[model samples]
Target: MTCTTAVLLPGTGSDEVFVRAAFAGPLREAGIALTAPAPPPDGTALIEGYLAAFEATAAGVDGKLLVGGVSLGAHLAVEWALRHPERCSGLLLALPAWNGVPDGAPASVAARISADMVERDGLADALRIATDGVAPWLAAELNRAWPRHAAGLAAGLRAAGAHPAPTLDALAQLRVPVGIAACTDDPVHPVAVANAWAAALPRAHVRETTLAALGEDRAALGRAAIEAWQQASASQGSD
Candidate 1:
């Protein structure tokens, strides 16, 4: 399928600003227009809001869409695609946190912890606690995005922490090509999870990068996912 447009979403407490920075250039170079929607402020409705946005965006397009995103965003994209397979061309999943249920996964645990902190200590204090001991680039990203979430930050984190990603069995049903990206050095989003996703998906490839590379250039993650997608697409075409 020819996909000229991509609708990418952001991770927990993240906004379209980060999504655009990560994917806009790479997608532009690939001649694909990108729509990075701003997530709704109400955390309770995040999943539904994201799905609605995807549907609305796809409605305006002529052909199937390249749908995906980072972390929780990636999970939600898969959920949407599973429901509307014909509308999806492929996936560009980055930093998949876990398979099946959250099940106290590292990412889920951290999200829950962060949510608790945000609720008890407020955004500024929670951010300090969350960013502490993290890489400067990551800290900077949280500082930039977290405040925008403000009052809804805790709810959003809790909602994401509780949400389950597509299970391995469900992934097997998705015949579309997928490109998964994993950060080799990032513990929050384990590479093992990405590998599991690749193993379950019918036509999927994984490209590994490091958090340091992503820190130096936001496009590093996007490039990894796109490269993996390209490989999957080539393999699918060959078959």
Candidate 2:
């Protein structure tokens, strides 16, 4: 339950800078040293790339690690923890976008749609269309990440869409505590996904967040995850 070291990964197209801003504050408060590494670039083996990244990071750590991430990164976090339960002390799954499998998952669907657009009209058009109606911060992030890795990110989404994600049966058997956070107003990462995860995991907690608040303070996402983990740990202890 004492998580001194942790590794965090960013979502598709995200770099280390984005993940650090999202995780630094809360992890520091918890006295947990965090290393947010950028996942491998878009490749044929997108999932495997992330899985390997998790393995490599945990291998370098001296003690049990708290692993967590956002969206696709979150998916990889749970998948890795399930495989090497001994290495994972806790999980902070923020904005879980897929459940059971990636087939027809909303997040993957959106990613694929974006990919198709980029492939058809090119990155500039895709970025302009995406950031048009969104908030400045959200638009800025989309502009920053999407253009940087448009092609690879699109390919990564296709691979992720074909992934057979963790099922409820698998989640029920998770050995480490879990904290699932979600933005209620976010369509891509639905709140229902987080709720389902919390209900299925034997020791999972949910922290409902809002898109507006998340836009205002990116660290709020990390705060929600850390607080939910603490709550889940407390409830398990009381039992």
- The lDDT leader among the candidates is 1
- Pairs that collide, model 1: none
Supply candidate 2's per-residue lDDT for 17: 73
| lDDT for each residue of candidate 1 in 1-239, tens digit (9 for 90 to 100) | 47899999999889899888888998888888999999788888888888888999999999899999999999999999999998899999999999989998999999999999988998889889889899999999999998887677888888898999999999999988999999999999999999999999999999999999989999999989988998999987722
| Candidate 1 weakest ten by summed lDDT | 230-239
lDDT for position 7 in model 2: 83
Q: Which prediction has the highest TM-score against the true structure? A: 1
Poorest 10 consecutive residues of model 2 by lDDT? 37-46
Candidate 1: segments with Cα more than 4 A from true spot: none
Q: What is the clash count of model 2?
A: 0
User: What does candidate 2's lDDT look like per residue over 80-185, in tens digits?
Assistant: 8888888888898899887776877787887778778777888889889877889888888888877566457678767766666678788888857788789988
